[model samples]
Target: MSGTGTATGTPTGNESNLESAMQLMIQTFHKYSGNEGDKYTLSRGELKEMLTQELGNYLGNPQDKDAVDKVMGDLDANNDGEVDFTEFIILVGALTVACNDFFQEYHNDDKNDKKGK
Candidate 1:
């Protein structure tokens, strides 16, 4: 499939796997970013909502104020009490890398188990 953009700002829908993943990331970010304050940034409330709703499984209990506070502090690189798209992307990228590492370790362990049988 050709990975090209149309003049209407819509993707050709023939994007490669990676391209589709990237688009999903953008869409996910915007889905949670523009609820409270700036349309382009995620306020604390918005971030908490997104984390609780979208990443609850990975992040554990979003109702834990301390956990949310730590995450907000860590992700707010500018100390502006808000997370911009770049900051949000960084968080997602870090999580993705960590998940990849976890999967690699699991796969290796499974392979070893099979070999031992």
Candidate 2:
């Protein structure tokens, strides 16, 4: 990695991949949060849009609004009807953990299969 922190500089223009991902997380939240009421938080519509556009593959298309509503209800945390950065981070952390668990399990299963052959 270069001293300027450009291991492979992304459009986010940060230090490393981890740094870039962190920056992207902040950037993404602000991108959607600013579209509506608080500007520092995400209204339901903004949340739905963010999830649909940013997490469509992981969260699914959310063909019914119920999923969005449920997510909003879960992430609101303070009953404010909006998702703040902290609440959003919780969601991201949770999803990350889930993905990690899945990948680890998949890898283990694959390894076991290989051993069986």
TM-score of 1: 0.88
> Model 1, residue 54: displacement in angstroms?
1.3
User: For model 2, what is the error of residue 54's alpha carbon versus the real structure, in angstroms, after optimal superposition?
Assistant: 0.4
C-alpha lDDT score of every prediction, in listed order:
0.85, 0.85
lDDT of 2 by residue, 1-117 (tens): 342344333353536777667768988999999987999999999999999989888887655599999899988889999999999999999989999999999999999999999
RMSD of each: 2.5, 4.1
Please give each candidate's TM-score.
Answer: 0.88, 0.87
Backbone clash count for every predicted candidate, in the order shown: 0, 0
Cα deviation in Å at residue 42, candidate 1?
Answer: 0.5
lDDT of 1 by residue, 1-117 (tens): 246474322467788788777777777788888787898999989999989988899888987889888889999999999999899989889989999999999999999999999
For model 1, the superposed segments whose C-alpha errors exceed 4 Å read 1-9
